[model samples]
Target chain A: MSNATNLDGAITLITGAGRGIGFGIAEVLSERGSVIAISDLDADAAGTASDAINSTGGQAAAFQGDTTSQDSMDALAAAVLQEFGHIDILVCNAGVIGAPGYQDRTEHTEADWDATFGVNVKGLVHTTNSVTPHMCERNTGRVVNIASQAGRKPRGARIALGSVQSPYTVSKAAVIQWTHLLAVELAPHNITVNAVCPGVLWTPMWETIAENQKANNPELSELTSREIFDLSINERMPMGREQTPRDIGKAVAFLASDDASEITGQALNVNGGAVMN
Target chain B: MPESSLGQLAGKVALVTGGARGIGLGIATVLVERGATVALCDLAQTACDKAVSDLGAAGHSVLGTVADVTSRDSMESAVANVNTTLGGIDILVANAGVWASEGYENRPEYNDADWDITHSVNVRGVVNATEAVIPYMKEHKRGKIVNIASHGGRKPRGTATGRTLGMPYSVSKAGVIQWTHLLAVELAPFNINVNAVCPGELWTSMIEGIFTNRQNLVGGGSGGSVRNEYDEFMQTTVPLGRGQTPRDIGKAVAFLASDDAAEITGQALNVNGGARMN
Candidate 1:
């Protein structure tokens, strides 16, 4: 609403906030003046993160909640309301890769699909649904869903051989479409819903992918993390370097802020220059 | 594409459809000013010749050709002559388009011929031109294609009849929207970048004609006047409280067609005055 960058007094919630992309988002959101509530399945890790935020003079609390459970989702919302009064931004960043080697079509199982979707797709919905009513009443809110470039551009050496087929891709694609639908539905209420499609960053997901590739082919030596990320935009990723989680965090913060009020139903790519659209 | 022109487009050649006027002419004018051998193509030979001669007289290497965008043979010949005369094609601006039924007076019984012509010139013509030059681009391993769409393709035009004269125009523009993505994906392998620009209302001759024709066909209705209707739409709908200019659209097209947009393929960018952020 204002040109100022101060996000002071904003109430923000991030799912799967223990580490990796979720933690990256939390750190940036807190730095920009938001009082954050970090939700994670691992209560201990979340506590440590909350403590870190507190030590840095940012208001934050940890909620040990399983995203797959409706009871946990409602409880997280209740706790946040009791602590912060209202929620202004919802970051649907929780996700899981399931077990290793699950991407191999021949080795995949229904359990892998259900597990990935339960935490990635259903989890996002549960968290977002928790914040909608409060945001609707306020007539001001921002919802940022973190998707992957893989969801839009299905390209990988293993994908060609049906080796990388997995529920992760399906779940992420669902997230992107879900963002699009919510954007229109919430337009009348002055709420903006957007998704960010980030390519391979130096995150835990990249490590998982690299390890999976090595496990699938013992003869194939693991490439450097930079090498893996460099391949995101056919190595022409315009930012001219591998992506750091900070790049994704900066974009998430920008979208969640008032500066992006006019932007909605759009999927902004923060993949260094990969996936420009 | 050719040794990175160092921003010349200098040694390269370019062509823009609908180049006789409006946004197309704006882009053609910029390209020529930048030192690229440019060509102007339009449905009317007289108009095309006039534009070419005018630009040529100003010390620019420019050509004018009468061609139907929807015609494959015409596009092939136009592209061939540019190649023969300038040696190669570097940039292609597919900016020609027509938008009738602006005020939705002919909602139910709108001219079928008008719809057919819009689709032919706006959508199919783009495909024909792109497909024609893609082969040579693949061989050369680089190219840039800019397709002009509209913000109307994304939002609905609300009117009392609820017709809004949008179905045909929006449908055709939507096709261009999807075509940008399809072409981007297909040409990325060949080092070619394909992008689309969705312009908001602009002060162009074509827009003036639409307003004048709307007033001639239908009275101001409940509104005060045609000018009043235009003012209300611009001030109320757009956040910036203003409209775009041909030069504004030109700057956006130039960005997408340049190396700055090298990694920006499959993108449908809005050059609206903050009307539609996506």
Candidate 2:
């Protein structure tokens, strides 16, 4: 599809851009003429993804930043502003599914809740706090948070995934609510904050989810991991298809664009295209 | 400045009932921007003509039809007009609505006529519009239907008087959501997905009336006093600290009509600046 909106010389900082949906967002924005600041916890992975973009004739610089640390994000934000001079967009895409042993928990522990929120929720605060002051100073910025469909809707009862992934889901719900509060606070600064809730996508995250589901669910024990993923997609997604990382990228790109400036504190679900029309 | 790239409804036809003004017109505007040939269905011929010509002057493919959602025959004729003039309808936004502001009190003890008018226009109108479009949509084997509901439908709003929102209007809107869910299931086989867009706060006549009534119930300066009250309400209750615009609701309805929301149906999506997240 031909893109009518162009970012041109926009500068965007995307957390967790080393792989998966974050990398997908980086690629799309870069295609639209954005100079990317790719920050990830894994330094080598970040460098590899940045190289991939630069090799494709896009401008991207990789930086290592641990989202779990406020000081790390603060330092990373300063380094990025120093490197790029101005930041136009920030994608809070770094997320953790659960606490370390959450997948095995029958009942979630307090540590599980704390660990999950520390990364998924507080990580966003660190990044936005470090960067939004500059945005307020300049009076221009966009913040696109990557939430999930699970945040907006409850998973069906009796689903093993629901119990195992409660922390991730709750944190995403927090992300959406936070998006609203920040949008309200930052609107005076001309900064629009929004969240994109993605549907089922084939990613490393899904790989783990599918593996666990196939092992845990009696109905899917015999099937391959891919089949299990496809089954979930068929059941959940009305279009009976899986979303690509680029599908999410398109949504993030739009939310970060100038045309959507009026849209703030909203969550746009990037699922199987609604085809409602 | 670059134009919006959110045009997923290109080459389609959209009909927005009650499209003469307010939220309906707002929805028509976005659909036209998305490259859809639009037809406005309204109760007033003059308003409809004015809306049509205004949009036409801006280089949009648009027309107007006179229809009353309370009258099935009137709606069917409007849908037929769209079919004959625009070829087919791929999208329908059932947006005609009325608040319980006529000859009634604002409290729970609102009079009988208000109840009749509320259900007649808000509830029956949505059903009429939806029923009129379904057959045509079924023939095409695909359609998107969006009903314009309100945040009042999901929860009971408050006034400084400690009185609740207009009960009849709120109840009718809730009924609209119920119908949307039911229609989604009934129409899914025909490739028709139905959803309700529950708008939060907007500065329309409907909202103006609400403010006027609130002032009547509890004095907020003059009966016309609303600016300060609106700001206070937004800052206090809404997380986004702002009222939604008609265009904001329009964008949401357009998205629901587009391929991006194909997975959504039988759902009441809130577009109220996070006023109500669930």
Candidate 3:
């Protein structure tokens, strides 16, 4: 078996565990034997993830909490603590890409920025802040934040050319910086904080963006929309290709595990060579 | 293009340097399954022949060649052979590399010969292979280069010996990053993508080399081989509590080589299992 396999019996909590990268992480972690706590904005979505895990004979529980709300974060953390006793791992994976057409700093409204920051940045902060105290008490813990490559390099074309926009990019950048900051602070507590920056992945979010572009940009056909989405990264890395949610999940699992103890305060790139750090 | 979308890389040609074993071999295995004709080149002729034959037995359009990535002439010949046989070169995985450093206290003094050899294979080797194939890509106006680096290159020297004890390996890897960046910008006009894949520690010949080096340095004692301590050290540090496998890196390399990553350019993808966030 691979060293990364068989993650059984570890108690782990994941924010935004309902779907996408967060859900993917939950799935892999469970497969590797981590007892999971799935937290999401939608209770039903979180239940679905927990149910999927249960169906596979894995131990999991679902918690519904508004990612942008402190009360929600606290309640979820409390529930996990009550049921699981202690959380060995925390994944602040909840995030948003913001509303479409919210391009350029000038066009971006304060409300839009606030909403994006609330979900992407503040949501992460709330989740981490809630779990870290317990973790610090234990003197051993792992926090994996889901960031975006947009945080590192501001490739305007990545947003302007496709579905993502300023709020998502800005919020992700904040998450990355915050990760570094937290890493430094938490390292002394023996708690490692790191972010997983993903490149483009074919997900429901991507489909929604593609559909919106097709419907909104009436001048372009559906086929053109697909091509436009395909042309995003400029394909600079000749050997391999784009980031996948599972790819990010695997990296997160690795980080959350004991194998990465010496690795503190580092931003790991899981973008399939799309963004090299 | 996620979740092993069937035939994503159908009808493509790929060349993986140092593809005889380890992460490179894993990448070649995946690409072949995805319907790409794979060409694996290694400095060791016996290893290359064995890999090619074994992969060929698996019903893949796979070929093996003996070539040193450190030498431009060797790389050129290998690329030329692949081009003639495979019809054209579309994907280049500059994955051939050697780890010469074990850290400071492990070796005490830096070995210049080890450092030079490491750079030749890791840095100059990647440059040589990419440079030799770029003209073909320029002719076709499209290509991809994935340079394999390490997560060790990303962090500071943790232990005295810096894990493997050689400064050149880390320095060369740093060079790999810049080289990837430079190539990415220059090849943009040619529609060629150049990126680096910084893999975390995996169980490969490279790691084995580190183990052997550590064992020799420490000699026979109650501690036994240095690999054990190194493995324990990795276990404690990696968030995931595990080391990466070759296939883990292979799947990532496969994604970067596929059309799904068309928009990605001049970037480094860390497959280190949360060891590095950026």
- Tens-digit per-residue lDDT, A1-277, candidate 3: 1233235578999988889888888987886678999988889999999999899867899998887888888999999999999999888888766654443233456676888898898888888878899999999898888888778785434444343466677888898889877876776578888777777776666655555555555453446545646655345333245456766777777677654554556666555455555
Fraction of native Cα contacts reproduced by each candidate: 0.08, 0.11, 0.14
lDDT score of residue A181 within candidate 1: 75
RMSD of 1: 9.4
TM-score of each predicted structure versus truth: 0.59, 0.85, 0.63
The parts of candidate 3 lying over 4 Å away from their true place are A1-65, A70-117, A125-150, A153-171, A177-276, B1-5, B57-61, B101-107, B157-159, B162-164, B218-222
lDDT of 2 by residue, A69-105 (tens): 9899999999998999999999999987766654355
Fraction of real interface contacts that model 2 preserves? 0.11
Q: Indicate whether candidate 1 or candidate 3 has the larger DockQ.
A: 3
Q: What's the C-alpha lDDT at position A149 in model 2?
A: 75
Worst 10 residues of 1 chain B by lDDT: B1-10
Output the better candidate (2/3) by lDDT: 2
lDDT (0 to 1) per candidate: 0.73, 0.80, 0.75
What is the docking quality class of candidate 2? incorrect
Model 3: CAPRI class: incorrect
